[model samples]
Target: MLGKLKDLLFSASEADARAADHDDVAVAAAAVMVETATLDGTFDEDERASILGLLQRRFQLSDADARELLAEAEAEQQDTNELYAFTRAIKDHFDHDQRVEMVEMLWEVVYADGVAHDFETNLMRRVCGLLYVEDAESGAARKRVLDRLGLSS
Candidate 1:
């Protein structure tokens, strides 16, 4: 029936739109993570590996997919000096708890090299503000990450 065909087509397009939205969110998150890892003027293997693992865990991506995402995100991040676009995508897509988790993820990337530089810390503060995550919550997330990594906060 024409009606049935229309429904099928509409549903397929709707699903495609959702998939695209999901991909946008994923790329935005990965780009922010890449920035976090590289903000300290160094992009070492440990930071790359940490971002790869975090991307895998956060988005449930396979190794190959995560690597591809990392590459795409790095390119995207390099192309833009503004964090607003990436943060806007994240803020629009993620709920408050997820945003907090994002802050935690940034914290993880910051400590990937077993040290947190001033620039990285400043970046986190600005990101948290943009994401509307409160300072107390961001501090708590940082503490949790530090505790997990056996580091003193």
Candidate 2:
């Protein structure tokens, strides 16, 4: 798992290097969102829509582009059972504010179905830990998301 992540995150191979130049940030963000949406036993329509909307708004992509990114992210998420590499990549690529925004995006996905399952919460904790986002910052991000969505925490 670590090896695979290292390669994906840091490899200088031609293909990966090209991909890294293209939109590593988008791929990494989409991958994390995909993982969150699927962490629970099911990936319902609500979760799917939530992720699509988040992707569109965060990345400023058109519906078609966002859908494409979502599809790519889903495929990548399925290939890995561990998120350490993705989170690590995100940590290395994103600044502190961007990481906090990611946490907010995650919270949005978690509450999209009108519920936050244990597995989903656990995944958020792990992702934040790997990103080196402080607990207080993550908690604040969650709260902001919940309040914006009018959901109680």
Candidate 3:
């Protein structure tokens, strides 16, 4: 059992390292946002713009750069299955607060349409666990996003 776990972590770590370059990081992060936006099978303009805005602000990228990253991520997401790849990339680079912020950005995307779907919520839970964020921290991140959007839940 321990050997299996070690092998899994080692593989994940190796994959993470391979995708650790700057552009790859942006693509990986944007892929996560893409996953969140498409969770409900209803990806829309609002969600797309929300993701663009988050990437712009979080990474301080220009509009073109953000759009480029978004396009790459959209393509990458279509080919990707599980989010473990993205989360592993994130876990290798981003610290606790950054992961918490990723959760918050995900919540913003989930609520961009003014309603949270069941799949969106479930994806957030799973991503938070993968990112090693505590439930309380993710809850706090959700609250912060809700407050920013003048929403309550």
Candidate 4:
């Protein structure tokens, strides 16, 4: 599974990306969460927990369901070539607030390690634009997460 994710996120082709449709919105969103968690090259326990918590709350799932979604997301993320397919599905299926909430989820993953790296923030920026999320909203979401985590922005 680790190797699959690395190959999907770190290396893939347009053909692989097009096949990303295998993932539904929840799975796609989970994939993006997984992507952010692994982007810093750690994939630490903290980030994993954050992703699980977010999936649970966002989808209102039981622990088992949440874990299943995460696993499915890991597989989906690993099978894809790009993030665009997921983002497009999300943008098409969800409303503006839901999209903003996703950005918030991404920020939570970014800060899961207690420190948001340059690459993480850069990924957040790109994802915000791809999802058509306004910069101000993304910043607000970041602040909300920081406040919840008791971290100073």
Candidate 5:
């Protein structure tokens, strides 16, 4: 019985590792979003909470899980050379409208602090391009986010 229990524990650990590997893309995307939200060197509490909330809602994750993913994402973002690694996974896994929604969500993060910085705007543009969202669609997404946030475009 002890041997069986040990085997079960080992299997569970392996499964957990595989699950983490599978979630790497989501973690990377979360990291990019967090990075963009903090582009101005000010990661306000509200903005951080908003990002955590979004991740929880979108990924169906618990607060702890979301935080863990965010931590992994933050580490990945630190060394990332381009947005392709994250965006490609999103493009492959999410539908077009979902991708568009992601763009809007990024815009929301940009606007969450009541101001959009140049770094944030440029990062959004680059991210949209990497996600294969057309310029027109990206603009529309921005507009949608502005409307949702009751901010002027």
Candidate 6:
């Protein structure tokens, strides 16, 4: 009976580890989005809504879940010392095109308030490089976002 109990405990510990890993991925992704939004030094309401909407749509999460995740992400981002903790998880989990899409989404957030800041642009460039997205692709994505926002180059 003791041996069986030990095995059960081991199995539960493995499950907990897996859950932690999954949470890490979700938190990392959320952190990336949150950090990108804060890059402009103006986390405006429109940008927040855009980020929440994207999270809800992408993760198939309800509004409450998305908000909770965003809150958790904000905390994690504040605690982290660098961007790699978030970018690495995204690079490992997402494909090239998906990363490009992420860049596009970030640009959308930057433009959501009807103004694009230099810091936001710089952050997007750095993030694109980290995500292994080519410069041309990143540029193209930015252009597409700008076009959608009806913003002139």
lDDT of each: 0.95, 0.87, 0.90, 0.89, 0.83, 0.83
Please state every model's RMSD to the true fold in angstroms: 0.8, 8.0, 8.6, 11.4, 4.4, 2.8
TM-score to true structure, per model: 0.97, 0.84, 0.86, 0.83, 0.80, 0.83
TM-score of 5: 0.80
Candidate 3 lDDT over 1-153, as tens digits, reads 999999999999988876566567778889999999998998999999999999999989999989999999999999978699988988878888888988899899999999999999999999999999999999998999999999889
Report the error of model 3 at residue 87, Å: 0.5
* TM accuracy, model 3: 0.86
Q: In candidate 2, what are the lDDT values of residues 1-153, reduced to their tens digit?
A: 999988876766767776664477788788999899888888899989999999889878899999999999888889987688678778887889988999999999999898899999999999989888899999999899889989887
Q: Who is ahead in lDDT, 5 or 6?
A: 6
Residue pairs in clash, model 3: none
By TM-score, rank the candidates, best first.
Answer: 1, 3, 2, 4, 6, 5
When 3 and 5 are scored with lDDT, the better candidate is 3
Off by over 4 Å in 4: 1-23
lDDT of 4 by residue, 29-143 (tens): 9999998888888898899899999988997888998999999889988898599988888888779999999999999999988999998999999999999999999999999
Worst 10 residues of 2 by lDDT: 13-22
Segments in model 6 whose C-alpha atoms lie over 4 Å from true places:
1-22
lDDT of 5 at 134: 88
Worst lDDT run of 10 residues, candidate 3, spans 17-26
In angstroms, the error of model 4 at 108 is 0.6
Tell me how candidate 1 scores on lDDT.
Answer: 0.95
Pairs of residues clashing in candidate 6: none
* Residue 40 of model 2, lDDT score: 85
